[model samples]
Target: MGKNLREPLLKLLIEQKEGYISGEEISQRLICSRTAIWKHINELRSEGYQIEAKPKAGYRLVYRPDRVAPEELIPHLSTTSIGRAVRYQRSVPSTQSLAHEWAKEGAQEGSLYLTEEQTAGRGRMGRIWHSPTHSGIWMSLILRPPIPLNQSPQLTLLTSVAITRALRKQTNLPIQIKWPNDLLIHGKKVCGILTELRGEQDQVHYVVQGIGINVNATESVWPEELRPIATSLAIEGGRTFSRPELIGAICGELETLYDGYLSYGFTPIRILWEEYAGMLGQEVTARTGQGSVKGIAKGLAETGALLLETHTGVQTIFSSDIEW
Candidate 1:
């Protein structure tokens, strides 16, 4: 009962920002003894929050761990649906795996599975995503849109635009979206999304959107082979980013766009995606299982496929690797 006020207290200190909240005021607002407040503050400290306590200046939040814990993110979230409920783990094989099971069991549409580290993280086409401890954001969101199965892939494009806008606004970094599911910074991969769908022939049961972002990682986190084509926000921006704030922003952006998409259609989201689209109208090779189709990069099709203008004609690539 005493420490139940801990989360609220954390919110209060966070509101103060660099300012201090007196112990007497904390006790009054929390309606507990100053001793109880002190105990909870210590608990927060143990959980990697830096709380500065002075003799008379009370408490100030010096730093909060770049964590995706429910308490760390929920208080700051402005979303009505997305991220309202967060299941967090210190380490997991993959957030996407848990999200799939949860979605099958009828998990809430906006339930989020978050983790600090993913030992077996995956990207599109079963590629290994580098998810070291505290290096980036690794989470999956569940959605049960009423759209048909054929249109489910559109959610992947929707999420890419959501995240691209969120990160660019927050970091002021020139983050761009690669076709299908990759975010690039200075032509290196900084984020990857994997969207898995489960449904009937014409109906969609649900979709699990797995988003992995390289937030605070330094260049050292990448393997030697990936060094040339992989990057992190910290490496590109020349500074680190707060994972919680970025997560909150993404949830908000996605929630707003998701609501609009459900009410309207994909036309608006498609146009927005074109604005942040990278490598448009350029020469590229589409490496598909069939074969590599070389052409000039066009834009997205109405169905969210990549359009490439070949020498013969404009080719619609449903899924392929674009080699630039």
Candidate 2:
């Protein structure tokens, strides 16, 4: 069985919606032998797909696992190449780490790497991102931009805007962007973005933007520490969302913003991001390695740094913990 045969077989099974599909039918439609069809079915099953097989009744797709695959997402995706090329894994240590390695090895820009679960997912400031199996979107993208290294933080802001837009498109839930790189739903954390860059002294060589969204995680599925403050799309929307749809939306928005940044600059993205950012124009506390500072969240600077109006004066905060 070839790679091309799997997609048509899956689509046929989905379209048929019948309890069983005969091996003779699959073999005829795919123009392959029954043995070849069986081989491909086994391959699909190995990839966590649940298929029921009977000696005479043939096969039936009992379950389609919530995993990000190029075949599943690309057909419905509306973008140039942001998610056109995907490397999907059932489980991995970290999608970001894998994306970083791929980017370093000259992977194409807009390449996406996703996993069903991440064992060592991380968030901003070295925080651990809870990515459980079959419950969230654990994905990373490789981007090659001509922007300077100092303007890299803007990428994080851009990603936030993209994710927020995607969530809004799929569900009517009100989503807000926390300062820097957190996505909140009804004032609870629902998503986090971690952006990393590898470059020279002046120019950015590549950037790996990692995003994790709590899609279908239930209250009991979350850790005790996060139950109070964390949430999932299912909890917020009262239903589970297609991870592939959300991923496609995010990748499309990202490509749009990336093109905008290259043409006009970060000014447009900064404006849009500020509109959705939480704590802006409100009293907030910022915790940094140096110390903590209380200030009013004025807005973001043109360079994407945090503009904090402190007691002494206005400050440009590049990175810090935001508490509102």
Candidate 3:
């Protein structure tokens, strides 16, 4: 096909699965020819779709793969922009690096770069992120919000709320957020967010928010040292989940909250964040470049900074690592 037909065609087949959809009807609705539909059907089959075809009958959807490709995700997605355009690969050095490059190359806002594995995945503070193949979510989302450069970090906080709220609603899991961008289940780390921006002194061009989730990975996926503090959804939930479904749910929640954030301000998202926050009322240490501050994890400031209730008073920490 001249245009991208896989996404819409997949959606049509999924929605019209009450019986076999005739090829003539698909071509008419999608505004294509029967031959073109046949070509795309073959393409989907190559990608592990079990589409049944019969002469003079049509196509019937048998099964779909557990892949995170756009064809597999479009049926589950309901957002206007977020995850509308996706760049997928089996493995990469880093999806964050690709998002930066693609954004500079004029990729659209809300373009998502996804990978099953990342050989050199990066975390905050230049740490290496462990990315296992076919067992986790290693992806980055591109956003071009019309916010000031200093306010970009709020998107990171908004992302934690989006993912946590989505997972909680879908699975009834007790997922909670740590200050800034970490999500935990039962006090063990399940997801982490790393936000980077391309901006000038006053204006922001775009923001690349990378999110890593241990979705269906088992205990062996983590390194021996990480077992004490790290966890995956399968470990806590005792079952595996569809990665594409989780991604769609997160994107839907994100697009909603993101639209609201741009309209009003951070007030609404901040309120939701506090409700899902973890480690509050617990004594913790934040290590900053100048020094360290020990205080109780109270809440967040308006600028997305972690608020700490110390003995002296409430200390507002901007950039620091939390130690508990």
Candidate 4:
């Protein structure tokens, strides 16, 4: 669909929420032909929207798709464009890969790429992130920060804080962050964050922040390998949620925290993150590619690395798997 068509189409959908809208009325408001309106409606339906057409009643949205599109998401979103420009795919290899291409092609900061499923999604340390079709939020955000390269890890922490805060606001479920970048509920993983960066000496270009949240999948839906460790929002919350609302909350919170980080550094967000952290000050084991370390989870360093206090002394770990 053309760029000019989005606003009118969204307005019509919102207005029609109260009742059905005739295609003739929509065409008049949009100042376009009936054929154009029909085409746009088809486009919306193709994106999984459940728009119903009646013989005389015209079109009525009996059900809004669970997918997050700008037309459906923006009316409820509270961000200043963190998700303002959204690109949605029915299925893709990975949101991260798509976002990377957009960034390389000069996509604006805060532009978002979301997919219903990721055929080849990956998590930290190159682990596969199982993203089944229509069952999760597989998305990536493109960000350009002015911070030094050494401070990039703070951005990951900030993303986690945003997601955790958003989930808390949208649902009554108790959510917590597993140090560094995972969202957990009842000690099982519900979400993962992977941040990738592009840069030169001492300067950073863009950071693609990929987030995966298991939304509607059941235990049986997950691969057998993930059943023991993975969880879904519906499983913990006891009901389904609107994906658009959740996405809006995430992007809105992200934009708010990103602005704070840029102006005041990571101090404020760091404190908030520690409050929701899963195992801070508890005994845990961290498995890294190099080796494993068992220690007390002290907290985060100023730059956002995990602070592990070993028997010998304090050690700052940049990345690891947390075993509580």
Q: How many backbone overlaps does candidate 4 show?
A: 0
lDDT of 2 by residue, 236-281 (tens): 8999988888888888888888898889998899899988887798
For 1-324, candidate 3 gives per-residue lDDT tens digits of 553888888888898775788998999999998888888988888878899987777899999877788777777889999999999988899999999999999989889999989999999999989999888889999999988898988999999999998999877889999877789998899999999999987888999999999999887877899999999988898999999999999999999999999999999998899999878888999999999999999888999999999989999999988886
lDDT of 1 at 280: 86
Model 1 lDDT tens row, 1-324: 564586688889999999999999988888898888888888888889999988878888999887778778877699888999778889999999999988888898999999999999998888888899999999999999998888987899999999999999999999998888899999999999999989998888889999999998877877889888989999998898889889999999999999999999899999999999887888988899999999987888888988899999999999888887
For all candidates, the clash counts are 0, 0, 0, 0
Sequence-dependent TM-score of model 4: 0.94
Score every model by TM-score: 0.91, 0.91, 0.91, 0.94
Off by over 4 Å in 2: 17-32, 46-62
Per-residue lDDT value at 20 in model 1? 97
The worst-scoring run of ten residues by lDDT in candidate 3 lies at 66-75
Comparing 1 with 2 on lDDT, the higher-scoring candidate is 1
Give candidate 4 regions above 4 Å deviation: 1-7, 45-50, 54-57
Which 10 successive residues of model 4 have the least lDDT summed?
1-10
Compared with the true structure, the alpha-carbon lDDT of candidate 3 equals 0.90
Per-residue alpha-carbon lDDT of candidate 4 for residues 47-140, written as tens digits (9 for 90 to 100): 6667888877888876666766566677777877698778887789999999999999999899999888899999988999999877888899
lDDT of 1 at 99: 93
The list of candidate 3 runs beyond 4 A from truth reads 16-18, 31-34
lDDT for model 1 comes to: 0.90
Which residue ranges in model 1 land beyond 4 Å of their true spot? 1-4, 16-28, 31-39, 52-60
Clashing pairs in 4: none
